[model samples]
Target: MRSRAGLVAVCGAMLAAAVALPLGGTAYAADTAGATDAARTAAADTPSALVLTLSPGESAQTVGVERAVTLTCTPSPGGSHPAPQEACAELSAADGDLAALPAQPQSFCAMIYAPVVVTVQGAWQGERVDYARSFPNECVMRAQGGPLYAF
Candidate 1:
């Protein structure tokens, strides 16, 4: 009975630590291209390091065209994302900073007001990541988000 009580206490402490980690974690945003060297290195050292949900959001349901996919980086970068390799490489280049992804501005876009909210929510190198943004329209979204949501 004494051993059993000790085991319960140890398990409880571990559970508490796990729950508190995210509250103290960093956003993993990059101030420089090299800022994520640690995370990138960690990812390379540990296979299958990134798993994120790339989405075009609820408005897709309204149009019956959902361009949502699960993307896995490292260990070959594969998932439902059409161009997983490119997407993963792009993400790695930005060091998991979704806002820092290079912009691929469209040549032109109709002045439309169809708002589209995009999101990338997942883990990067053991750190929590939650990102979301609203764009004026799909064209604008493509221009700003680049390949991350080009699916």
Candidate 2:
């Protein structure tokens, strides 16, 4: 009877510990609610960071052509990018549509087959934007260049 009572107490203690200690640590309704509220407030108050990258495609073409730039277009457009205001204006005009950006005027381009890839990640105009596109050559990419790809 003594052993049975001890086993029952141990099991009760284990159960209590399990209930009190969740996977993420202590589980308290008020504390969890406060944490969630703080996270929400932080996200609401923080502006999204834009990540842009330019790289040479896997064609063994360009020897060394890689560039990366980050921009925050919300509240204002600013970051490591060279022309923030113009880039922001272009993006805003396109409504965050990468493909909608106007193509540069027609120009003579060599028939090279080197591919270039452009990637943009982040939010724009209160909407999430993740864009990646490949062009057949630097010339073609430049042909499609707006302030977004001027780098």
Candidate 3:
């Protein structure tokens, strides 16, 4: 039918435009990398913030280890952490479920008890997360918290 033929032509044109748009965008980006870097810097500086602390215990409030990192997960994740990409990947893998981060195998943990507290507070995937958990020791924290709280 003529209608079917016309529909195919329209679809073909739409597909071509869709393909061209991205190629055009790449060319535009190539042309504007210097100008865009400032904007990108500003965007990166925008806070997707998280604060992590490790303390001796829940009662002792002075932090033994602290890391304040800003994460940007959109358009590709990046931030100030030592392992930004890995941290983002781990968080993404957990779907922002901090509790879902797999614990290290029991075999890896030493039978030591020095009471360590781990705290995480910030926005993750646009939702605010405030979590504080005290583990038996540093080993326990590492065994349970994985890389997101490793720092």
Q: Which one is best on lDDT?
A: 2
| Native-to-model Cα distance after best TM-score fit, residue 64 in candidate 2, in Å | 11
lDDT order of candidates, top first: 2, 3, 1
The residue pairs found clashing in candidate 2 are none
TM-score per prediction, in order, is 0.60, 0.60, 0.57
lDDT, each prediction: 0.68, 0.75, 0.71
Look at candidate 2 and tell me the lDDT of residue 80.
94
Candidate 1 at residue 70, lDDT? 76
Give the root-mean-square deviation of each candidate in angstroms. Answer: 9.6, 9.3, 11.0
Residue 77, model 1: lDDT of: 79
Deviation in angstroms for 41 in model 3? 23
The 10 consecutive residues of candidate 2 with the worst lDDT sum are: 57-66
Q: Residue 139 of candidate 2: its Cα lDDT?
A: 79
Report the C-alpha lDDT of model 1 over 1-151, residue by residue, as the tens digit: 9999999999999999899877756543334447567656766655434333333444433443244677777667787777788887888888778888888744578998877777666766566777767777788777876666776
